[model samples]
Target: MKKLITYIVIIAIFITGGTALTGCYVSSKVANKSGAQLWGENCNRCHNAPGPGEFNNDNWDIIGTHMQIRANLTKTEVDKITEFLKSANN
Candidate 1:
């Protein structure tokens, strides 16, 4: 009976630990994708210039709208770029 309890406890620990670690991994992935740096040196040549960490409520939506057309970026690229900009908290 003791051994059975111990085994159950171990399994529970493993399950809980695994879940917590998985959450951390997921959060890190989101941060990584959002935190990606937008290189103005290349990105700006075709689009209006964006300052790193400069995307605030004042300009993010507008910038996102204008950039998609000027850069001719696809929806995915636009989303990624906008996400990155938002993550910059500009």
Candidate 2:
């Protein structure tokens, strides 16, 4: 009984640690992405991807705000995508 309990605790600890490390790795990967990469990955997930110059900065700002909610995107992602669009439009 004691050995079984010890093994279970060890397994639980490893699982928890693994999950934490994975989350950190994923977050770091996201942080390193460029605006263009994020735009391609996120916008295309729902409908067809829009051309970067399809809208002005103001327009992109509004769209980004909408998408942030509708698409469940992080604020950082939306900001990056919006910036990419604004720059491309220019």
Candidate 3:
């Protein structure tokens, strides 16, 4: 009976801990950030990013997709960065 109670407590702790950790992977809010800001915050954290003029809109889209995954960026961040690059490319 004592062992059974200990096992139940351990299981409960594991369940709660897992749920809490899961929140860290997901974006809590879509931040209102400029392209340059997002680029600096997310992209520059890992490596230097090329100037916006270096790539066309389509290229930015492709590169954004790849970087999104590589950087673990949220959809909102990807969209903002892509828009920023597109505007700056002009």
- TM-score per prediction, in order, is 0.44, 0.69, 0.64
How do the residues 1-90 of candidate 2 rate in per-residue lDDT, one tens digit apiece? 999999999999998998787665666677999999999999999998899889888999999999999999978899988998899867
> On residues 10-82, what C-alpha lDDT tens digit does candidate 3 reach at each position?
9999989987886566554434467788887888798887777788999999999998898888677899988
lDDT of 2: 0.90
Clashing pairs in 2: none
Q: Is candidate 2 or candidate 3 better by lDDT?
A: 2
| Model 1 weakest 10-residue run by lDDT | 33-42
CA shift at 63, candidate 3, in angstroms? Answer: 0.4
The per-residue C-alpha lDDT of model 3 at residue 57 equals: 93
Candidate 3: lDDT of 85?
Answer: 85
Model 1 TM-score on a 0 to 1 scale:
0.44
Model 3, position 32: C-alpha lDDT score = 47
Descending-TM-score candidate ranking: 2, 3, 1
Task: Give per-residue CA lDDT, model 1, range 1-90, as digits (tens).
Answer: 999999999999998998788654645444444324444433767656666577685476677667678766545456666666676663
The positional error of residue 6 in candidate 3, measured at the CA in angstroms, is 21
lDDT of 1 at 39: 41
How high is the CA lDDT of each candidate model?
0.63, 0.90, 0.83
lDDT for residue 61 in candidate 3, whole number 0-100: 96
